[model samples]
Target: MAVTFYYAPYSTAESTKAILAELEHGLPNPLATRIELSISAGDTRKPAYLSDVNPNGRVPAIVHDGVPIWESAAITMYLGETFGVRAGNDPHQSSLYPEPGPRRGEAMKWIVWTNTTLTVAGARLAAALPVGTPGAVEKGSQDEVSKDETARKNEEEIARGDLAKNLKVLDEALKERNYLLGDQYCLADTHVWTFVSWLSVMGVSTEEYLHLTEWLARVGARPALKDQ
Candidate 1:
């Protein structure tokens, strides 16, 4: 069966793509049966595209054979299960999301936290930021940093603070462990890394949190992170 992934690299869709990439090397035959479709706005909203597959016109959709699946979280879960590799050693028994256990519980926390709390606040702050404000150097030097700007800044601060909170928790959790889910890397890393990795491509920076910085680097260094 051929599986086609529809998404945009710099958008929230990248979450699924990153997770799939993490799964690639773990799978028996990673790229042998999968196709990725970089869905641009023009493509996703098209009647033909929507009618043929997802009707909501949202991104991160997947089509396996003739069947289409929408939603980023669902897509990642599906890929992790479909490809035996991403599931880690025993995919059939534990992949994507493992059964109830300490690691599984933490994995669920990070996965849900990344999308619900992190993405939502980040997207809002991103919307508030003055478009094309140049880079950090330029944005930092603004004379007044308006109230609206202040609010947006607060939003970003809040988001980053929350991210920091989570990161700190993970870092402490990782005191002696390597991955989020114990010694074994699993869906938790893939799910959280997807969005954290997208910050740069999304035009956001993560210079404040040292732990987060290191964690993100480690995740980015994974071999499965390949170009689309």
Candidate 2:
């Protein structure tokens, strides 16, 4: 059965695009047909999309073999385990997810953490930006920013400090490893890197963290992510 991926430009769906490309490069066959939706036009709010695709009405959902799956973590894990192989297969070896054991547990842990903890930290930084900054309006500022200028500035300071603390955690984890799971690149790397790159666009810098910087470079060099 074929898969249908629902995506929207300049959104979280890009991570799914990258992972699909990565998997198809080494899998036995093609993955799915991508259907791009326009969030600005309320495509996700359409009745058919809400009833048939994602009940949550979010982009990045996929319909595979007539059953729909939503959430980045679920989609990544399914693609990885279903078609993933280690290096040196006839087609090539694509690993969308980690193998069993300690690495698998760590990958699962970090996948959710990156989706929640790391991403929320990044969102706070974006939400706290002052008016007139590029991309701030698209990201949506805090409600407090509209009512209290002083509160918005306070929020920006707190967001900055919190993000630094979270980055330190990631930086320390990458100090002795290449990818999130030590050396083998998998879905977790792609998932986390998506948001990290997003944060950089909002003015968060990773240059000062030596380990984190090197890790980002290594992941950024992947062939699958190039086109996406």
**Number of the top TM-score candidate:** 2
What TM-score fits each model? 0.71, 0.87
lDDT of 1: 0.61
- Candidate 2 TM-score over all chains jointly: 0.87
Q: List the residue pairs that clash in candidate 2.
A: none
Looking at model 2, residue 23 earns an lDDT score of 77
103-192: candidate 2 lDDT, tens digit per residue: 778878887887778877766666667655743534331122453778778877888888888888999999888988876888888877
Pairs with backbone N, CA or C atoms under 3 Å apart (clashes), candidate 1: 26-85, 27-85
Model 2 residue 130 distance off true place after TM-score fit, in angstroms: 5.0
Best-fitting candidate, measured by lDDT? 2
List residue ranges in candidate 1 displaced over 4 A. Answer: 26-41, 85-102, 133-170, 200-210, 226-228
lDDT of 1 by residue, 1-228 (tens): 477777654556777777766655555664424334444325666787789778986677778877898877667656655652323355343354565566556666777777777666555555545654422211322221445657767766776566556556555665555677766777778777776665565456666556556666776777776443
Per-candidate Cα lDDT values, in order, are 0.61, 0.77
